[model samples]
Target: MPSPEPKLIAGNANRQLAQAIGRRMSMHRGMQIGLVDARVERFNDQEIFVEVYENVRGEDMFIVQSTSNPANDNLMELLIIADALRRSSAARITAVIPYFGYARQDRRTKARTPISSKLVANMMVSAGIERVLTMDLHAAQIQGFFDIPVDNLYASPVFALDILHNFKGAMDEVAIVSPDVGGVARARELAQRISAPLSIVDKRREKAGEVSEMTVIGEVTGKKVIIVDDICDTAGTLCKAAEVLMDAGATEVHAYITHGVLSGPACDRITKSKLKSLVITDSIQPTAEVKACENIRIVPIAPMLTQAILNIWNGTSVSSLFDTATLEPIYEPLYPGLAFE
Candidate 1:
């Protein structure tokens, strides 16, 4: 028997990305996947309501929602949307969460704090989510919290292609630096991809989102340093590491981060900092100030995401989708219609 067509239902969070994914999928696969009509809106009292206009019975559904800034609201919307699809007899429901909220709370450091990542996983499972697709989760171990299959996509292939193209002439002088110890593996992987040196920023945080002092652990002096990280919330770590790298006689500094949760003076800090540019993926929707920043460049994840969806639907290995060692043409243009600032 022929399988039903796949559909993408988007929540308010990162709608642009969702739309881009839908369009890319259709364009590349001859209308293989489509954007479904749905209303995810707020009531008069600010309560959420979702109504799927399409008959999704026995359909393969992918719900695109980013549990970003308005964490609670976005999370609720995804859960409700999944519940609606499950109730409508969808064959399968995969939650595509580009930016997972509560990911930072994977483990409890304090006495009373909860393992919110696990809690979110439980909520999604209870809401009838059969699978999860997310990108560069705050902690890799967050995947273990879920009972269902989880695909934690990497931004390295996306970042690597961009770096190879942008820094075409300076690969010999380029160095990939991790902003902190936690990101060493990510930075190291990129360094290996582009055949560049690796560096790490040794820093101590007084509290979350605050960096006190930093020291460089590798030979970054006279090198064009590229700091790699998963999330850039306040832009504090990137800015601080850039400053410390400059103080260490580094030639130039740039950052390629996966999720740009640029909130609260992040734009201002990036503008005033010494870093040449901060590249980020559109995992989360960019705000007005984030779009207005002169030094911030956004690389769309839609093409890779479209390919992943195709791979998943075709029963191909999604794990083999992201690779940059050969530096082959991953995608001709990262984002077709989007302009990079």
Candidate 2:
């Protein structure tokens, strides 16, 4: 007998990404994977209201929501959705969060502070989510906070393919740069994939949201540099790092980040900075300001996400989808003519 179909539901957080995932799954599976109707609205006084229209009784459910800007509202929306599905008798609920906000607060640095990431994890479990599917968490340790199974996806494969395609014959002259010491591992992986050298930027953080100084630890002279990072909030670190790299005689500096949380003044800073371009995944929906920035390019990770959902539904391992050794070069754009603006 065939397996039962899984229900795909999305909130207001990232409808475009959710729809793209649904469409890709439908095409790949040779059957429609339409998103289940779910209304996520607000009361006049700012309370959240969620109503899952279709019956989810005993069905496997995936709720796609990225708690991006207005993080609290979106987070609450996801929690409510999970609770609703649990109450409706869904067999299992998977929270597909592309851009997990508050992930940077995974650890406490000061005298006394909360680990907000752990709190978020607990809330998901309490709301009755059985699993979590997310990408490029700010801190990997955040997974340990969750009791339920959490599948953390990577964008290295996607970025590697794009770098190979775009950089082509210039691969030898390309260097992968980690914006800070913390991202060295991620940068090394990409560098290994593309047969490029790795470099690190030693930075001192005087306070939150600020990088006081940066020192390059590798030779970037006359090389095309690609700064690799997980997130770019204000574009401060990236912008400063790009300036330092260029000042060190690098030909050009580009960035490939997983989540572009391009908050206050990010687009403007990127616009005026020396970075050649900033390529980011569609984890967080770009705002109007981000779309207007010519230096910014948004890549679609929907195909990858769709395959993950399909694998989970089929009781298969998710890691196989991104196994670099066996993965082929992605020749075609996942979403053709996807307008950034």
Which predicted model would earn the best lDDT?
2
For 1-341, candidate 2 gives per-residue lDDT tens digits of 21277789998989999999998887877888889988889999999999989989889999999999899999999999999999998889999999998898989888789999999999999999999999988899899999989999999988887787678668889999998888999999888888898999999979876778889999999999999999998898889999999999899999999999998888999999999999999999988888889999988888788888888888999998565442342225542332211
**Clashes in candidate 1: how many?**
0
* lDDT scores in order: 0.87, 0.88
Give each model a TM-score. 0.95, 0.95
Model 1 stretches with alpha carbons more than 4 Å out:
1-3, 207-209, 325-330, 334-341
- Alpha carbon deviation, residue 50, candidate 2 (Å): 0.8
Candidate 1 lDDT, tens digit per residue, 237-302? 789889999999899999999999998989999999999999999999999899999999999888
The Cα error of candidate 1 at residue 159, in Å, is 0.7
In model 2, the worst 10-residue window by lDDT is: 332-341
